[model samples]
Target: MYRYTEFDKSFVKSRAAQFRDQLERWQDGRLSEDAFRPLRLQNGWYVQRHAPMLRVAVPYGELSSAQLRVLARIARDYDDPDPDVYRVASAAQGKLGTERLPTHCAHFTTRTNVQFNWIPLEKSADVMDLLATVDMHGIQTSGNCIRNISCDERAGVAPDEVADPRPFAEIMRQWTTLHPEFAFLPRKFKIAITGASEDRAATAWHDVGLQLVRNETGELGFRVSAGGGMGRTPVIATLMREFLPWQHIMNYIEAIVRVYNRYGRRDNKYKARIKILVKAEGQRYIDDVDEEFRQIVEHDGAPHLITPAELERVRASFVPPALHASHASHASVDEAEANANGHPLFARWLQRNVAQHKDPALRIVTLSFKRLLQSPGDATADQLDIVADLADRFSAGEARVTHTQNVVLPWVRASELLALWQAAREAGFASANVQLLTDMIACPGGDFCALANARSLPVAQAITERYQDLDELDDIGEIDLHISGCINSCGHHHSGHIGVLGVDKDGREWYQITLGGSDGSATSGAPQPGKVIGPSFSAAEVPDAIEAILTTYRDAREHDERFIDTVRRVGLTPFKTSANAVRVNEEVSA
Candidate 1:
């Protein structure tokens, strides 16, 4: 984990204080809501459907135990909505045929940020104060500025990693934070970086995707792609640069964003993403960027070109933490395997929730937040504290938020696997279904988000309840089932094997199912959007339709084939036929 220097600490505290003053003026009627909206958004505060939501940037998904504890404290102390506000929100949600919304909880977003949906605007300053104490804030988390830079959760520890991307991600964070040049662009821009061979970070689906690669001379550089995004129109980014020297990444990205800032659309927010511009301009856009780069270097002297010394300064902060000396005396690999074999539940957890690490003695263990009744990616105040404690005890005082909306103890020792599993199981976070169907990704839908056309929680809950059997889930195998309440794609539904998108139809909630989406992982192949099977189904029929599709795959899949592979090989016809049958049956029953 990157430690915040005194300068970084002071910068965050000053920003928080500045936001406090802005909030005070807004509260006293000196500033209009229209005027204060941008001010609040720049600080990571948003007036959502029923409450003021706060999104705290967890840069590159890294979190210290102390930071996690502060987050837990915020959830416990400041996330409660006013009684009247809760009552009205609950009533409105009930009318939509969904359960009352949960408060005093933090949701781990697909972008690896932390969100609180029910915090009051009055306490915003105090919350900011608390976040600053931990060197965390909502800066650039909600505005149309450069949002938080995300990276592979396993960046430093993955076995196949070529280089640790955190150093570069940190450098980008420093360069982009409050960048006056790119702030308030045509739309919110996202960037993802991964150093691993497997595309664990889903870089291809980002506004700017960067893969750390080596050129012919084995010199470190970046494979840059731009324009990928998901919304009303999903697009895979076009390859802009095959190999850009690592030192010039900041300079290159500046040219890319600068071109977009100058030429990207602004009139319609719907069509303002860089993906739209890239799609419309195609090769012309690349040519423009190349020309811009040339001008920036030759004319502007490439001021942002990173120096080797500056790179080393940032990289120094990411030095791997020393493992406990006791690890040398811990149980051997054979003994750990024997222990896992003895406990079937532990064995299952080790297989599903744990991943290989660069160090054989260390394992990356996922603490599953997806469980019965609880919303996926949501952690209660108590659960957050438990995770903090677990991280301190098992993972060298650090944990990471994964892109799939789960928590990862990246430094967990192999010997502590059983103990950590026991503690997590006691805390309702040891489901051992990391990428299973039950482990779905969902956003705060109409129940909480004002932009949602339908509720995603109900559909997620329904599917979770339907697939509660661990044996059945394991048998079904790894499947990405992502649900989004709207076309915004907050839940990354466009990349799921079975994607469910909520839609509005005649003032009622409906769902559109898609098949064969991938996030460009080693397992999921290339990054691409799923295809809709047919017309939308009522929210009530979504679960049954999903079941029908999964059943189709199980019946026809070849031996040991994953759901995605099976979908690819057999095509969407069988799944589509079964899902459509469910829709017809529901209509007839109704």
Candidate 2:
């Protein structure tokens, strides 16, 4: 975990003070809502249906126990306590008191950020202050700026890692913090990086994606890609550079974003993403960016270079915790294995949430926020404390958030696996549904966010309830089902194998389905963007429609094929036909 130094602390305190002044100006009518909109967005404040939503960035999904406890404190203090907010059951799903409302819950986002929904607009500064105390902030988390830099959750401890990407990710985070030149680009931008063989960060769907690669001579560099994003026109970014020297990454990235900022569309916001620029301009865009990089680095001597000392300082902050090395077998581990064998439920949890660690005696334990009966990415204030305690007990007093909206304890000992599982289960977090259909991703839809066309949380719950049978889920293995209340793609429906997008049809909520999409890791190719299946379904029909698609795949799939593989092999005709039938039958019944 990274601690704040004097300079870092000063920067956050100054920024928080600045935002507080901005909020006061708006309240005093010195600044109109229109004038303050962009400023507020830059600081991660959005006026939602019930109240303002603040997205606090958790860089690369990393957090220490102390920082998480601070977040729990914020949740307890900052959330609105209005009586009307509790009237809506979805928003108040975890109501705790005579009680409680949906007021203080925090959502862990798929982008590795935490969102405080229902926070009062007046208290945005308080939220900022809490985050600043823990070396966190919402700066550049929203708006048209480059959002948080995401990387593999298993960055340092993965055996397959060529080199940890955290140091470079932190370097980029600092450079792009508030770069005046690119802050108000055509539209929002995102970046994902990985040094691992597995694409856990979903690199292909970001505006800019980078992979750390080692050359034949064993020198490390980057393979840069541009134009990737998800929305109305989803695209997997094109590979722009085969290999860029490690020292040149700073300037090289500046050059690519500069090229996109120059030529990206401004007429229609729909066509404003860099993905559109990459798709429209094709190879010429890549050529122009390369030429710019050459001029900046070779001709002008790279004025934007990060000095070695600065790089080393940031790099040193990300060192992994010291741990006892892994072992083949140990007393605690052997006892745990025996206990797991006897307890079938614990065994199931081990098979699902646990993975092999780089340290042979250690294990990777993923805690699911998308449990069978809860909101996809939400955790109550108390739940946050539970997470903090679990991290302290088993994972070196630190935890990492995953892009899948789950928490990762990357350094838990295998010897303590059963004990950890039992503790997590007692806390209602041992869901045993990692990367399965039950582990669906969703956004805060019409229930909380004013931007949504329909409610997303209920659909996720319906699917989880409909598919609670582990045996059946195993039969239909490896399904990426993403549901978004709107086409903003916050739920990443465009990249899901079974994509569900919500639409407003004649003032009623309807869902559009898409099949054959993936986050690019399921298959041995660039991710396939989703395509519309047929007519939309009403809210009531969504669960059955999903069930029909799964059933069709089960019947039509070849031996040993995953759901994604089946969809790829058979195209959308069979699933489409069955799903449309379900849709029609429901419409007639209505």
Candidate 3:
């Protein structure tokens, strides 16, 4: 993990002092909510339904054990101590308690490069102190700003990767942290880089996705995808540069950001995402802008001087941990455990969720979020603490967060699988359903998100509940059911084997389904919306619709066929008919 240098520490301290002063002004009524909104947002604070929520960016989902311990402390000190009490408590009480004290909901997510929580407005100073100690700070995490630049957590270590993208990611982070050049963009922009053969970073969903690849000539390069985003208008991004050499990647990205910053729509906030810009200007126009920017950088001979020495300096900061030669051979224990435990569930999880490591004997264990009957990508504060502890115990002194919103203990031994599973079960993190149908991704919809047109979580919950039976879920095999509140596709509905998008029709919520979309290494595309299914169902009917679709697929699928392959071969008409059939059957039964 990259420790903050003296310069980095100084920068954060300065920003914290600035924010503290801003808070004081707001307290004295010298600054109105309107005046403070942008300032607070820049620090990743949002006033949510229950209380103020702070989203701390954890750059590329990599965090030291010490940083995670601080997060646990934040959860225990600021958020509710009891998970049950916290979940059901009244908003007024929660807010009152949080307001009276410096409480916050400590959350670790795959987005951004920092961890954030909802702390009391008054405690900004204290929070700043805690951040300073860690040499971490919230500088450009929010606002209509260039948010944290994300890169693959396994950037330097992945054997199949072209090069460590962390150096590039770090350079971009430093350059864009608070750069005045493109600060006041039309809307928030996101940038991500991946050094893995697999699209673990989901670069396709970012405003700018860079895939680090080696060209045919064995020269380091990048495959750039531009205008890709998740928002009201979802576009899976188109390839802008087939092969941009490593040296020119940053320049090209600067050019794209500049183009969007200057011409992207500002009047309608809904249309401000880069996806819309790509659509309005066309790919050719965006390409021209990128070319023009590249020309300027090349002509000036500015970006060219970032030599091997500078690259080495940045690389040294992100080098992989030193492992001992003695830390080898957990395969025997893993095999023995599997033999004793007749549960194929555990075996399947081990096979799919674990990754091979650089060390011959060690393995990278992924704590998969795809679990039967669990809300995809959601973990309570308690669960967060538990995972943090496990990371310390098993995965050296650091952990990795996946773009899929799951945690990865990237240095666990294979022998510790059973023990780790036991601990996870105690913490409610064990649900042996990685990649199954029940591990659906869903947005926080009307229940929490103000941007939602319909409630997405409840619908997702309904589907999970319907398929709650572990045996049934296992039988169904791997299927992705992703739902988004609106076209923004925040939940990545467009990339699921079964995609459910929520929309408003005549002031009532309705769902549009799509099939065969995927966000895997081989396939990178958005799922096209299928036939409209009429007015959205009540919370109870949501499950019924999903069940019908699944049943239809189950009946029609060939042996060993996955949901996506089945959908592609048979089309959505049968699923549509089945959904209507289920609706009619339920009405008659009722």
- Runs in model 3 lying further than 4 Å from the true structure: 80-118, 157-159, 324-345, 369-375, 504-511, 520-535, 586-590
Q: In terms of TM-score, which candidate is stronger, 1 or 3?
A: 1
In model 2, the runs with Cα more than 4 Å from the true position are 81-101, 306-310, 323-335, 522-525, 588-590
Q: Which of the two candidates, 1 or 2, achieves a greater lDDT against the reference?
A: 1
**Candidate 3: residue 456 Cα off by (Å):** 2.9
Q: Report lDDT (Cα) of residue 340, candidate 1.
A: 88
lDDT of 2 by residue, 445-520 (tens): 7777777888788888888888888888877887888889888889999888888999987777889999878786
Best by TM-score: 1
Model 3 agreement with the true structure over 1-590: per-residue lDDT tens digits: 67788888887888888888999999999999999988988877776543555666676667777776666666666654333333554242221222222133343344634333345667766676676677666666777778877777566656677777888887777777777866788888888899888776778877888888888889888899877775556577778888887777667777787788878888999888878878777966566776777676877665633567877887887765665233656665567366537867666666656666665556677676554444456555556667778988877777877666667787766666767767776776667666677666776554445566676766776676567677787788888777888776767777777778877776667677766677654333342333344444545666777788888888999997877778888877888787777667768889
- Best candidate (score: lDDT): 1
Residue 59, candidate 2: Cα error in Å is: 0.7
In order of lDDT, best first, we have 1, 2, 3
lDDT of 3: 0.69
Each model's lDDT: 0.90, 0.84, 0.69
